[model samples]
Target: MAGLAVPTWDPQTALLIGAILFEAIVLYVGYGGLERLVGPRLMELLVGGDSGVGQ
Candidate 1:
């Protein structure tokens, strides 16, 4: 028997959590950059050439 199997705050678990958080931040920044580059143009195309953002 492995005796009282209590959970421990392992380094691997901490690292995994950190990696997930880093990925989320990176994705957010990437999407925000993409939006800044193309969002207004995309909106204009969809709304027939009058972009509300520019005004």
Candidate 2:
């Protein structure tokens, strides 16, 4: 009778997971920057004048 086989590490799966993690980090930073750059302008346009919340 054969014993249970152990699972081997998969390089392709590891690389795929690494790439997904990298993309998520990049997207998080990129969106944060975009929000900082455009959030105030968007609020001004939607609210019509200075909200004065930041100041």
Candidate 3:
């Protein structure tokens, strides 16, 4: 005969969950900083078109 098993809360499971949450927060903050640094340059490149030099 065979038996069925169910999942339970344990230290390893908690550690893995915590690690994933930490990674999500880190990525969010990092991408936000990168966007802030590069967003202005990208907007200028898209909208300026390099024609307004002497104006």
TM-score: which candidate is best?
A: 2
**Model 3, 4-52: lDDT tens per residue?**
7676789998999999999999999999999888977777777785646
Q: Count the backbone clashes (under 3 Å) in each candidate.
A: 0, 0, 0
**Pairs with backbone N, CA or C atoms under 3 Å apart (clashes), candidate 2:** none
Candidate 3 residue pairs that clash: none
Model 3's number of clashes is 0
Q: Where does model 2 exceed 4 Å of error?
A: 1-7
- Using Cα atoms with residue i matched to residue i, what is each candidate's TM-score against the true structure? 0.75, 0.77, 0.67
Q: Write the per-residue lDDT of candidate 1 for residues 1-55, one digit (tens) a residue.
A: 5877977898999999999999999999999999999998888788865557667
Model 1 segments beyond 4 Å from truth? 1-8
Which residue pairs collide, candidate 1?
none
Reference-based lDDT, residue 16, model 1: 100
TM-score of 2: 0.77
- Compute the lDDT for candidate 3: 0.83
Measure candidate 2: CA RMSD: 3.7
